[model samples]
Each structure stands twice: as structure tokens, then as C-alpha cells.
Target: MTTLLCDADGTLFPSEEPAYAASAEVTNRFLAELGAERPFAPEELQAMTNGKNFRAAAQELARGYGRDLAGADLDAWVGQEKDVVTAHLRTVLRPDAAVRDPLRTLAGRFGLAAVTSSASSRLAACLEVTDLADLFDAARRFSAEDSLPVPTSKPDPAVYAFAGRELGVTPDEAVAVEDSINGALSAVAAGFPTIGTVQFVPGDDREARAEALREAGAAVVVSSWAEVVELLT
Candidate 1:
């Protein structure tokens, strides 16, 4: 049977606006508590945080605040920020139930799995919040604790291979739905029929990233989960 592997963050949930806002607020407050001034806006901080790990993003933000923070200080900042972000995320994350129905329908015809860069806990929270937890037959959620020999993450294809292995399917026998460039590239690189779902269409740059994914060998680019379901059907 064909398996449909899906991404979680931008694919299942929004771009984490409320979480970013909370993180920024906590960051500013933390800086003030340390007798420092805020350096970046929430939006700017959000951009810096994207596609990066907690420590990396935290250290980057600290540098912007004119502090050479690393080690425990960076870790502490990230921990505090995470607590604030998680609280806010629990409220503001909106899942597309429209997509969930289609996923359920597809599950009857094809195996379904969630393959995401997020830690299992966060992914589970997202699935629970979206009421999509029951739709997936399996999930290959990655975390820092996973001790794979290779640095396997999105855009590397190892994560997709791992998911396919767990689902008892080959990459070519599966379809992948992804929102980010890295996620799409990972699926394509793994030889899956990858579809790029454009969650954010920023002006003319819409086609740019999509075309880049296409050039990297994605099967198609779509704007919605409906389109992905249509292709699978």
C-alpha cells in the first residue's frame, strides 16, 4: 500500500505566531531583568528563530542584545523562552480540520504517517490540538535525543528513509506532503513523490521557492491540503 508521509509544523499548524510573540516578550523581559535593553522586534526574533535549534537561536538573539552569552546562560534563556512559547502556543495554534477529514479518508486507501523535525512531544501536542492524532497510522517524530549516527534531519533524506522503514514501505512507494523548502527537498531526495504545500505566499517569491523545489525534483507544488488529496486520489 502507498503511504502518505506528512510534515507537522507549517503543514499541520500555523507558523507559531503566538509562540513567537510570547518568546519575544519573555526575551525582552529577561534582558530587562538582566539590566539590558531589547534589541530586536518580535518579528525579527521570529525570523531568526526559524529553522534553528533553541540554543542556536538563543545565542544569536543574545549577540544581538550585545551580550556574549553561551553555555548555561544561552540554555537558560532558551528554557525560559520555551516555557512562555509553549503556554501561548497551546492557545493560538489552529489546525485545519478540513485537511484532517481528507487525511482520514486517505488512510482507508493508503497508509498514513507523520514525519516531522519537531520533537515527539511538540508534534503530539499539535496533533492533539488539531484533533488529528488518530488519523495517522504511525509517526516518525524526531528529537535531539534520537542517537542516529548520521546528522539526519530535513533536506538530508535520512528522516524520510527512517519513516519509510518504520512504515514498511519504500520511498518511491510513498507520497510526501511538505510546507517548507527543507521538508520538500528531503522527500524528493528520498525518491518519494513530493508535493510542496505553500503555506506562506510572500508576493512574487511564491513561485521562486516552489520552482526551486521542483528543480530539486518535487513532483508538484500545491497551495492546500485539498490539492494534495486531489493528487493522491
Candidate 2:
């Protein structure tokens, strides 16, 4: 049977704006704390950590400011930023109502699973908030916390591969729907047919962002759930 593996952040959840804003805010605060000359632009900041795992993103942000963070300091910084971002997410994250019909339609034809870079608690919260808890079960849900090394995040197909195995589906029998460059790369690397969604990108930049996702490894780029429903069906 075909399995539809969906991403959480910008795919089912409309969290791009809040996530980007929170990251930028936290990064700017960190830079100020370090007495940096300038903060990174929104695009630059997001591009740096968009699909990266937590440790990697934190390290990159530190390096951008020429800070050699290690041990407790690094952990503290990363933790603080995460707390801030999580708080912001709590206030704004919501389901993409536009995907409701598509999800319902596809449910009849394919098994569904959620593959996300978030931890278990966060993922659970998202599913609950979106009323998608019934569509995904614990066995089929894969999160960053589920990774063997404990924090192995995306762009490293480990999570996707694990999800495929857990769901008893082979790469060819699964389709990954993603909304970020890294997310697309991870799915493609895992050998799933990948669809990139531009729903989270700004209207003016959708074309460029979609192109970037395609370059990153997505087989197709779509702007709406209607298009995705058509393509998959």
C-alpha cells in the first residue's frame, strides 16, 4: 500500500512565519548579548538553520558571530533559544485548513504518517491542536527525538528511513510532502518521491523558494493543496 509521509512544520501546520520570526528574534538577542555588529536578515537566518538539526543550527548561529560555544554554554544557548521559539510557536501554530479536504481525500487512498523534526511533546501538541491525532498513530509517527542518537535531525534521511521501516513501506511506495529545502533533501535522500510545497513562502518569493526546494531534491513543487491532490491522485 502507498503511504503518505507528511511534514509537520510548514506542511500540515502553518508555522513558517512564527518559526522564522522567533528564530530571528532569538538570534538577534544572542548577537546583541555577544556584542555583534549586525543581525542577520530574515532570509539569511532561516537559510542557515531551516532544515538543520538543533545542534547543527545552534553551532552555525554561534559561528556566524565568531563565538566558539562548547559544553554547557552551547547547551544553555540552544536551550534558551528553543524555549523562546517554542513559546512563540505555542501562540501561533495552527493547522492549514486548506489541506483538510486534501488530507481527507487522500486518507481513503493511502496510509498516513507524520515525519517531523520536532520532539515528541511538540509533535503531540501539533497533532492535538490540528485535530489530526486520529489520523496518525504513535507507531507511524517519527520525530527528531525518535532518532537513535537522540537528536539526529533532518536533511539526514535517518528519520525518514526509520519512518519507512516503521510503517512497513518501501521508498518507492511512499511519498514525502515537505515545505523546506532541507526537508525535501531528506525525503529525496531516503528515496521517496518528494513533493515540495510553497505554501509557507512569501507570495513574492514563492517562485524562487520553490525553485530552491526543487534544486534541493524535490521531484515536484506545488503552491496549493489542490495541486498536490491532483498530482498525487
Candidate 3:
């Protein structure tokens, strides 16, 4: 059985817009309070935040404005951004309808598991909001924050490798679905045949991003969940 170990953000759910919106809002507000320059462009913001955690993103945002924020300043900014996003998570995060049917179809054909970098509570909210909680059960769902011992970030294969173990499958018997370059690297490096989704990337840059993902070790690049299902099926 090819266990489907999927990412929640950008894979099962629509997370890019909300994430970017919150990042932009937080960045601009922080800059204004400090009387710094204006926010970075969307592409710059994407490059900074797409693959990094909140602290990294905050630090990058500060660096973009010609400021260096570290230590307590950086951590406080990251915390503020996270708090803002968490406050609006339920309103902003949504599931792609295109993924739901495909997931339902694939569930019977293959083992399904959700491997996410999201905090467990946020993941639960996202799943519940999308009515997808039932699709992945407790045992099948793996959150990086599920346990303190588990590393809580990607581009480190620990989470993907752990998911394969919990699913009782080897990398060759599974597939990893991802939308970001770092996520693809994590899965592919862990020995899963990774599929890159370009749905979250801007349409103009998708080809470039697809090429990047290909270089990052995706077996294929797809534009939507439909293509993902077609490839998996």
C-alpha cells in the first residue's frame, strides 16, 4: 500500500493567502511602530516567508528594511505575528474542494496520513473548519508539535521519516505531497517520491517555481489537486 503522507498547508488546505496576509500586516505594523521603511514587495515577502518559521520570517522582514532584529526583539515580533495569524486562523484557513474528493477517493485505495508543521491546535482547527477531520484519524495524523521530542520544522526529514514509520510503510511504498520547496526537500530527501504542487505560487512564477521544485527532487510538478490525484491514482 502506498501511504499518502500529505502536507496540510498549501497541500490539503489553502494557506498561502492567509499566511501572506498576516505576514504583510504584521510586518507593516511593526515597521510603522519603529518608523521604518515601507513593507517589501509581495515577491520579496514570498521569498522570505515561504519556507521559514515565524522567527526567520520576522528577521528576514526586518533585514529587508535595512534593520537587524535579533534576540528578544525578533522573538517578540515573531510571537506577535503568530498571535495575529492564530486569532484569524479559523476565518482565513480553508480546504480546497478539489482536494477533498480526491482525498476521499484515494483513502480507499491507499493509506492516508497528514504530516504537518502546524501546531497541533491550529491543525485541528484547520481540519475541523474543512470538515476533513474524519479523513485523517489520530493515529494517521502527525503534527510536528504533537510531541516535544519531535522536531517541529521541515527541510529536516525527521517528520516525514517518522510518518512513514508510523504508517508501517517504507519511503518506496509512499508518496509525499508538498507545495513549498522546503517541504519537497524534506520528503524527497527522506526517500519518498515527492509531488510538487504549484497551486499556491503566483501563476506568473509557477513555471520557475515548478523548475525549482523539480530541482529540489520532486518527481513531478502539478498545478492542482486534480493532477495530484491523477498522478497518484
Candidate 4:
């Protein structure tokens, strides 16, 4: 592959669980405002919307209640969610050599870009905390929320397509590393040979997660970044 489209949240770092912890607060607030009957616990929300952005998750939740979210209201909540999650992640995330070391090695052989459904600020904090920011240029860090003409979230291939055009690479020329079913679906939809990694998934869930990702069109599912390194390098 000529390029590597890396997913940031659960793929590049173990930010999902903690990020969700913070997001639940904001999400609960939104749910209350929407007049939804109940608040979702952090894990419940993660299970419901692991690979999607706040906007997408909000729409899905609202739909279940027959509540159509106004565009402006959704947009505002999305921003609020990002701010809260980013702040929480920055405080909780720490550098991990397991993640940084392999990507550092892989960087020599491939063009790298972070392509995610996260807002730009959230992606930036992830890269920064993991000491991975230097590996990709700001121009190479593509966010569905910040980079698209029409903002969207994974399970939607728009961001991946946008990255391909800007980077001048076809799916045949690049591979994607994603940790969520929706994320794998996004890359596969864009025609990339996707590698679904479950390194960040909880230990008890890894095997089941692998199976789910495989069903989502991943060429293979790996347990760690080292396996990813061995396959591509």
C-alpha cells in the first residue's frame, strides 16, 4: 500500500473508553434536552455508537425516540461533546511505546495520515498525548467533522473518500487500520483493504470484536500493532 489511513480513537490509542466516560455526561445532557426517557451509561453509549461521531450517535438515538434533531441543535451538541471529550482525554491519555514504536517503524515505509470521525481537536489531542503528532502533518490529519464539506461520521465513507482525493491515492494503493466495525465499514466502502485491529478493545471482547470486524469486510483481524507491522512490513 502506498498510504496508511490510521484510525485514531480505538486504533491509534485507547482513548475510546475514557473519551466515552466524558462524552456520556454531555450525551446525557443532550438526551435530557431532547426529552428522551433515560440517560445511557458510558459503556452503554459506547456499545450503541462505538465508531460513530457524536452527531451520528445523536441522530441514531433521536431516531429511536421518533425525535428529529434540528440541524443547529445537533451541531451545537456536537461541539459541546468534542470540547468535553478532548479535555478529558488530554488529562487521561498517556504516551504508550507499544503504539508509538510500531508506527514510528512503519512511517519509514508508508505515507501516513490519521483519518477519523473525530473532530480535529480531539484527533490532535490523541496524536499529541501518544507522541504521534510528529508522524503526520497537520495537512495529513483528516477529520470527518473538520475536513468535509458536509460533515459526517464513520460507517459513512465520505471522510475516507475525501482523504483519497487530497492524498491522491486509491483504495487499491492504500490500506486502513481500524478498530471498530463502523470504521472498518467506512474504509471497506471506500474500497481500501482494511485491517481490523482489536488491540484496544477490552480483553474479554477481543475475540468477538475480531469476528464482528471480519463480518464488516476487514481482510484480517489482528490483536496488536505488532501483527499489523509484520503483515505490512
Query: Can you write out model 2's per-residue Cα lDDT over 1-233, one digit (the tens) per residue?
Result: 48999998888877666766877877777767777788877578776678664556766667866887668876676676667667777777655568777888888889989998776666677677777777787777888644456567788888898888878899878899999888898899989989999876778989988999889888899988778889878
TM-score of each: 0.74, 0.86, 0.81, 0.97
Model 2, stretches more than 4 Å misplaced? 32-35, 41-43, 64-72
RMSD of 3: 3.3
RMSD values for the candidates in order, in angstroms, are 4.2, 2.5, 3.3, 0.9
Estimate, for each residue in 171-209, the C-alpha lDDT of model 3 and write its tens digit. 779999888888898898889999898876768988999
Better of 1 and 3 by lDDT: 3
Instruction: Provide the lowest-lDDT 10-residue window in model 3.
Output: 144-153
Of models 2 and 4, which has the larger lDDT?
4
lDDT of 1: 0.66
| Candidate closer to the true structure by TM-score (higher is better), 1 or 4 | 4
Q: Considering lDDT, which of the candidate structures 1 and 4 is the better prediction for this target?
A: 4
Clashes of each: 0, 0, 0, 0
List clashing residue pairs in candidate 2.
none
What TM-score would you give candidate 4 relative to the actual structure? 0.97
